[model samples]
Target: MKLQDSVIAITGGGQGLGRAMAEYLAARGARLALIDLVPEKLEAAAEACKAAGGDARAYTCNVAREADVEATFASIIEDFGQLNGVINNAGILRDGLMIKARDGEISKRMTLAEWQAVIDVNMTGVFLCGREAATKMIENGDKGVIINISSISRAGNMGQSNYSAAKAGVAALVPVWAKELSRYGIRAMGIAPGFIETEMTASMKPEALEKMSAGIPLKRMGKPEEIASAAAFIIENDYMSGRMIEVDGALRL
Candidate 1:
């Protein structure tokens, strides 16, 4: 798909990587539908996209809710007239080990709420948004792309049982959607990002960030623009479906 004049919808577009991607793609001449929960952040991100050299509109949405996703995508298509792509980028982190024990004795276990919260936002939200985007794209006869933002933690990370599980689920959907949507000229892909310089990671302690960065082969965290560049490449390349592009500076979980 060409970036020029393309209509791309992004979840979690209020800030961080989602906003970075919106600006990156917008600069390439694509129109954007920026979706997020915060009205103020969405408006700011939309304005930023417009300032980046393309048109953009803000839509407040809760991607985890089916009704919100359906309505948001419909509105995107209604407003843009043609849907070209969507990025399932909305996610939440509920970090905790499933079981916390001292000396093999019972201590604390991850609550159901912790697990469910992450699953609802990260995994279920991806499914809901992907379904709505595909439906809209098919109805409009647009050859579009769906990019799911997975994570290196999908490989399984300590202290992140819920996050890892949700990430893994989204990663698995890439090939499934690619095969299922191929007939309609729609492509599906995943991006498993390692630690990056986002608001979430930026809030970590300096020593924690330094230690984490040292573990990566590149000895530094990735930039949001780096991930955004990978997303842009996926949208621009026609035959790059059913696979994930990891932008982790060669880091592995």
Candidate 2:
């Protein structure tokens, strides 16, 4: 719970929100296990975490693969000698409308492959990693937390049927994990971010970004550090569990 020396594993820690959290938590003295599919990115992130004033190591693994998830968690525990928390943050965006039609005639439909890909990484990946993390925490007698990275698009946004479904599924798991893991002193929580200015959004045209920002009550996109701050708060607040913290600038999908 205390950031000082608490060992936390983060998926997708190579960049974006994951990297931001790694640095933020590291700055507060938490040890980090930065997991990602890309070895280079993981190495860089781990170094960055160390620069932020905490110990950190990198692991390369695919969250969508059960074997990878299992081995990764095991390795984390073996290296860190204790496990405290895991942030399920690895995800991919494959945005497309379920059906594209004009005058009732369908021009295109979301492919099964497309849907399955997102579900595998965004939904099932969370399941595998969360399961393995909780198991390790309990076996090691470490009280910890699980934080799922969801999105406001979980409310069902246009042009994102696959992503919406995947995010919604993870968000729904918050309560289930909390109720199940609480007996072992492990807590579960979720964060549903609205429009945030990450690498993905940073490349958008200025006009489009302005239009998107206009809808948010804050009239601006969120920063990755802000989301990281929310995550740190959740980990430190022992009483908070089974809740989804919306950092959306009051914007509704």
Candidate 3:
């Protein structure tokens, strides 16, 4: 699909990968509806997109909430007159081991709250946003694309039972949504990035970051723009769907 003048909705558009994608898409002439939980961040992102020469608007919405997702999409359609695509980029990390013991004594374990929180945002949030986007597109008879953000941790990482499970589910949704939405001329795809240089990874200690990068074949973290480029490719390539593009610099863990 041509991105010029197309209306694209991006969740978690305030920062990191989402912000990069919004700016990239905006530069390509796509109108944007940037969604985020923080109003200030949403405003800032929208401004940046506008500066990139695209019509952009900001909406504060929690992707994990059904009401918020539905309402936000409705508002987007109302504002843009049509919704052409959606990027399910909103996610959170609550990494922890399932169990932890010290010297034969139980110390701690991953709490149900941590597990549920990650699942709610990473997994359920995608479902809610994708469903609403598909519904709107089918109703309007608009051929569209849905890009979901998965992670290298989907392959399973230690100390991230919750995050790993949620990301794995995200990867699975690509093929399932593709098959289910093909009849509507809507394509579903995923991008699983590994150790991207985003705010999430910036919090790591310097030594830890160095060690992580050393393990990757590229010996460095990926830039957010690289992942944004993948999204653009999927959006423009009419035949691409039902698969994931890994932008992890050949990192496997």
| Best of the candidates, lDDT | 2
Number of backbone collisions per candidate: 0, 0, 0
Better of 2 and 3 by lDDT: 2
* lDDT measured at residue 248 in model 3 versus the true structure, 0 to 100: 92
Residue range 1-253, candidate 3, lDDT tens digits: 9999989999999988899999999999999999999989989999999999898999999999999999999999889989889999999988777999998898999999999999999999999999999999998888999999999989889999988999999999999999999999999999998888988789989999999899999899899999999998999999999999999998773
Worst 10 residues of 2 by lDDT: 244-253
- Please give, for residues 134-245, the per-residue lDDT of candidate 2 as tens digits: 9999999999999999999999999999999999999999999999999999999999999888899999999999999998988999999999999999999999999999
- Which residue pairs show collisions in model 1? none
Residue-level lDDT for 98 in candidate 2: 90
Candidates' C-alpha lDDT:
0.94, 0.95, 0.93
Model 1 per-residue lDDT at 224:
94
Question: What's the TM-score of every candidate structure?
Answer: 0.98, 0.98, 0.98
